[model samples]
Target: MDARKVEKITALLISAMIVCLSFSGEWDWQTVGIYAGSNMPERLLYPFFHTNMFHALLNSWCLLSIIFIYDIGIGRLLSAYMIAVTVPVDTLGYFTTMDSPTVGLSGLVFALFGSISFEVLRKRYYQLWMLFYLVAGFLFPGINAVLHLWCYVLGLIMALLNKPVKIMHHER
Candidate 1:
């Protein structure tokens, strides 16, 4: 399978899982924290749990859109990098807060904002778009605006420090 195709399929599967979570009503906000927190045995485990239907739907939409965009506009590696940054930040939020349950892919969305900002900085295009992302990050309600801000900052740092590399480039 082509890498891009795999990514698209993964995005769709994730979105499907989100829809399932929306209907399951099994995992609550606190339960999601347990799976996504820093104390986890592995970071890969966090993406499985969610808070509610709304949370799942919001994250699913954002993840699918971002992955789709990154896969096309940037590359598969960058899309994976965005997801990598997002998961840790999502977990970190759980660890940092005391009884404050964190859920959703808002952190990843913020990371996308950061990545886009980096692209703008590198290419000198989309200044207005970046500004709009910042505005959206701040203005969006019920979406961890603070986490988004921090993740954006972190993503900027990652983009600056790390050289772009293509991962999963070969077809499976």
Candidate 2:
């Protein structure tokens, strides 16, 4: 499948997949997201699934925004990246002081932000400084820094490795 098609449907498909999860009474991140106790299959579901409506919507919005603004380069890579993006984050979360189930699309969203920064800004200090403003959430309790950082790093890697499609500015 093409990456463009995947990008277009990603938000809807993932959002729909978790709607029934909300009604399934298994909304706990422990059951649906990645944690130390999570099996391999559950870990596979971590990046794409959400435990609540708000979380799902927030991620869907992020995904949609990236689809519209970013080139996404290759659609198939988007699918692979979406799934692989969470691995290191989850692994770090599981190993590094995450005593409870940590769940949210924030990591994935952050990854998108990171990829956009790396691919578009390309180490331009002026633009990269904007990333500092995103620090507020990092200080919040129950938020794992390792997971977010790792996801971001992976996103950067993918964006750089996959031939970044830097959307050129075209003034109307």
Candidate 3:
């Protein structure tokens, strides 16, 4: 599918998840990944729900921007997020903490940020000065800097494999 179509579908899906998560408190455990005994599917669910509207919006904006800017397909976006952020978090959280639940889409957003940042730097696109915004997460003290850093590194790996080559024409 095209990037626009993928973006629209993503927006709709995220909106629905946000509404469902907001109204259903009991379902929080279902959407958010907990440090419980092995439940493999929970890894894939981490990106769909958030702690609050602000958290959802933060992730949604990052998601949309990455999709639109790089024209990343839905499958690529979903696969990268699940593999880069969700799976590792789920596996590690289980062994590390057995009670606290990790809830938020920040990991996915960090991956996106990392992908774009890596592509920009690797290509030496200095005119893309907007990369300075990468530190935007610094404003939010609650962010998982460690998790984000790991996911970002994974995103860079993904970018290297995918190679952002579709947009052959750079803006002059």
Best by lDDT: 2
Task: Please give the RMSD to the true structure for each candidate, in Å.
Answer: 8.0, 6.3, 6.2
Q: C-alpha displacement of 11 in model 1, angstroms?
A: 1.6
Question: lDDT of model 3 at residue 9?
Answer: 80
How big is the positional error of residue 145 in model 3, measured in Å on the Cα after superposition? 1.8
Question: Residues 72-159, candidate 1, lDDT per residue (tens digit)?
Answer: 3335335544564345555555434434455555565556556655454445455466566666855755445556566667666656
Better-scoring candidate (TM-score), 1 or 3: 3
lDDT string, candidate 2, 1-172, tens digits: 8766766676667656656555565566676567755787667666666656776677667766776777654443354457444465445754467576666666766666666655564577724553563454466666666666666666666657766467999999
In order, the Cα lDDT scores of the candidates are: 0.58, 0.62, 0.60
Q: TM-score each candidate.
A: 0.62, 0.68, 0.66
lDDT of 1: 0.58
Q: Which pairs clash in the backbone of model 2?
A: 3-75
Q: Choose the strongest candidate by TM-score.
A: 2
Candidate 2 vs 3: which has more TM-score = 2
